[model samples]
Target: MPSAAGTLDWLPLADHLDLVAAPVASAAALVPRARVARIDAGLADTAAFCAAYDVAPGASANCVVVAGRRGGATTYAAVLVLATTRADVNGVVRTELDARKCSFAAHDDAVGLTGMEFGGITPVGLPEGWPVLVDEAVVAAGDVVVGSGLRSSKLLLPAADLLRLPGARALALSRPA
Candidate 1:
């Protein structure tokens, strides 16, 4: 297991359920290697969290919700990219989701549909059938910090482990920020 750096005290997620969101807590069984750390909710946003925790921006990953529409059907997906890059939402993502249009999901829709806070929507417990589009760079990053489905906590684990999550797919899905 990777050790936590900076000022945070990381604890096994299974033993620290109260710090995470309901969905993340319920999914703890699926993440034996992950550790969770409580943080000031006010710093949950990526940039603030990284700076406050003394973490490198490239070693943090962000999960974004995308809404893709084609005809009368709409599809939702999770797009994960390193903090140093941005998801190719209009090009790669639209093509991958097989939608005529794709963009970041509305804030309310993302929170309502995923049952997670706007800035803390991790990919671990996403709804079934929602594709998890992981950027290849994220997969290559051995260990990284990610949201814990709540603004008050964060998750730390080997990036490669994300592939075990349901609907996960590795692809070149990001461009430089």
Candidate 2:
């Protein structure tokens, strides 16, 4: 239950939901029941997350932030993909952001924008302004793990809930990486 800041305070996902300004509905609103657990290891990096959580690479989902141009202005969006495959940021995400140039947002920027610590970031509970791009593979999955509005824990929810997250669905935004 330790935090990235090395604080002793630890709260469960259920407890932190009240602290979030966004929605707190269950994954059943979109998909079926799935297992949820609290993680104690640091998920600051993909390899570390997978190893610490014992998450199968093929069964895991990765959420990333992509910066691009939208409506002739620079913008950023979150993209979700299976851990087994990389996000197609430069291809579809570039066009989605409507930018001639696009790339991953800086680490600090991504964490600040999403309001969640790195490695624990999921498509859900993001600020309203940021769009979410979901890979089709994720949607096909029955269940997935996402952020619980905190960095120390993750929620196992239906992939369909990912679609329910604001701006989560946008066709052709993903491709084999």
Candidate 3:
């Protein structure tokens, strides 16, 4: 596939991915079809990544980790939303998680739990039992781009394929920015 930087060497998601992102590769394999591409690690953040790679914002998905507490127990979830919108962390997400209050997970915690870089967490390789709450719009966006758990690559797959991930579920979890 071609990108702003020239031709993108799209490969199976399982190949040429970092070992830390193995879970993402494993989950991606479960999908009927998935592809990945290497990119400059410095451009891993959404805006830079899209611009540097010639990807439309709408075609890029961002996965954010949220955390909250209820009944003295902490709960966490990975929320997937398009770059064009913002995840409703305090509203729909909190309600869905049955949390009294919710907020984006701290940098260290998110990286520690998922073993993914700060700007490269993806729903594909989240901790077991953590909900992968995808915004409804994301699933309807056709094939979308997402982080590869490491900052060195990104995955491309149908939005619906994300919903098929082990703990993934679609919800009205985002609002336009």
Best by TM-score: 1
Better of 1 and 2 by lDDT: 1
In candidate 3, how many Å is residue 75 off?
A: 0.8
lDDT of 3 at 64: 93
User: Candidate 2 on 1-177: residue-level lDDT in tens?
Assistant: 311212223334444454322333232233234333555636635566556656555546788888896556778888888766777778888877778888988999887776667677666656677788888887776556655545555566567767766667745555555
Candidate 3, clashing residue pairs?
A: none
* lDDT, candidate 1, at 124: 83
Q: For model 3, what is the error of residue 149's alpha carbon versus the real structure, in angstroms, after optimal superposition?
A: 0.5
State the C-alpha lDDT per candidate: 0.90, 0.63, 0.83
Which candidate would rank higher by TM-score, 1 or 2?
A: 1
lDDT of 1 by residue, 1-177 (tens): 223344688999889988888988887787789999989999999888988988778889999999999999999999999999999999999999999999999999999999999999999888888999999999898888889999999999899989888899999989999
lDDT of 1 at 6: 46
Per-model C-alpha RMSD: 2.1, 6.4, 2.5
Question: Over the full model, what C-alpha lDDT does candidate 3 score relative to the true structure?
Answer: 0.83
TM-score of 1: 0.96
lDDT of 1: 0.90
